[model samples]
Target: MALKPLGFYQRLQQLTLPAQQAFMAALCERQLPNYALYAQTTGCGDTHALKAVLDLVWEQLSVRGASIDFARQAEKLVECEPPADDDSFGARRALDVVVSLFSLLDTLRGEAPEAVLDVSRTSRAGVRAFIELTEGEEDAQRLALLIRDHPLTDDENGFQDAVLDAVSQPLNKALLKDVRRLGKNDGVSNLGLSLE
Candidate 1:
């Protein structure tokens, strides 16, 4: 979303309760496509929008004691939505976007819930992934830490090395590229939201 006109994504970072409630009303009605389009054109964070949309969907279903099926729902909303050119490339591209959105929201669960809620725009599976991670034991934490300690952007396997060399803070050069690059001034606009 930040790559698009992500104003809403940024606003979500500081969204008010009343604003959230009001948005939820519209979002719950499955009218999120409009807002999603707006967010996309604005080059904002899709992650933020997906999170909100997912949350609204979860609330509606959970409140009604409904069965939640993210995979089936993902197919209906995204998979079956044929691309404009009837090309598989577009389908793959769209699927990639959905996957990216889900992955990002899953990452943000570590953030403050309010802040995360404002910036996330994930689906049920994404949220459930986040929830599951939160419920993990030391094993999970250790695995995540391992990933954070390493990235694939350094050495011969700079990216591979980083992931294998995962460590705690005091991030090393091997993992420098593994961390957030959005904050850097590399003569290119950084998204600044890589996995940490």
Candidate 2:
């Protein structure tokens, strides 16, 4: 069965705070290539800075009392945002990656109760945009069903399920490592974009 967005959000909410943070981080990790490709193609954003933020986020999740300057990190992320008027698919995907990381940071800061949900939505929206671009589907209703049933969408849901299952277990450095590997998906993004 296909996983609905609301159902996914509900499952995400059931995870503990650390688990939720890890989930968001894993999703962000999967999307990093989107920004990396955008930066490589257009030289518009800093891929290294975004990677640093995600690294710190993972450190906070895995290491106890790991003090992270999230406010400063958020400021750095703001600088990485793609121009709103770029209107390219690459820029849109890059923006989605940044937004997902920002939501993760907001969750870490206790500043947004729905930050996790926002990450979930943003990730799925990125996939949807990818489908729309490649498939050339113009009918709204048909595209909605097409997105719901797409193989990439299935991969996204399956990836999230795997991350949740790994995180729901006892939290530890090893588990976080495993989750990060899972998110890497052999360096492919949820939409199948890769740096290499």
Candidate 3:
């Protein structure tokens, strides 16, 4: 069955805090390449800042009670956001990556229990946007169904499921490493963009 955002959010709320952090971190890792590619193309954003924030997220998960300054990481992420006026499709995707990282940081700081849901929704939205842009399907209802059936959407849901399963187990260094591997999805993003 396809994963629904609301259902996914409800499940996320049931997990332990560390588990949720791991889940969000995995998703952010998968999305990071989006920003990297955008930065490579436009020279408009910093992939390093985004990578630092994600690294901090994984660290927070691996070291229980790790004192990460989430606010400071967020400041760095804000600097990496694509400009509001850069209306290119790639720019919008880069912004989604930034926003997903921010949501992950917010979740870590305990400022937004719902932030994981935002990250999930944003990832799905990025898939939908990609489908719409590439396919040029203008009908809202048709586009919604198309997105639901798209291979990229299926891959996104499958990746999330794998991460959720991995994180549901007891936390450990091995588990964290495996979760990160799952997030990497063999260095390919949900949109099928390779890190290479």
Model 3 spans with C-alpha error above 4 angstroms: 1-7
Q: Backbone collision count in every prediction? A: 40, 0, 0
When summed lDDT is taken over every stretch of 10 residues in candidate 3, the lowest stretch is 3-12
User: TM-score, each model?
Assistant: 0.23, 0.93, 0.91
> Which runs of model 2 end up more than 4 angstroms from their true locations?
1-6
| lDDT per residue as tens, model 1, 79-167 | 32334454342233333344433333332232333423422333222233333444454577765554344331111123212222232
Best by lDDT: 2
Q: What is the lDDT of residue 10 in candidate 2?
A: 81
The Cα RMSD in angstroms, rounded to one decimal, for candidate 1 relative to the true structure is 17.9
Taken over the whole model, the C-alpha lDDT of each candidate is 0.34, 0.90, 0.85
* Global Cα RMSD, each model: 17.9, 3.3, 3.4
In model 1, where is the ten-residue run with the lowest total lDDT? Answer: 187-196
lDDT of 3 by residue, 107-160 (tens): 777768787778888888888888898889888999889888999989888888
Q: Arrange candidates, best TM-score first.
A: 2, 3, 1
Better of 1 and 3 by lDDT: 3
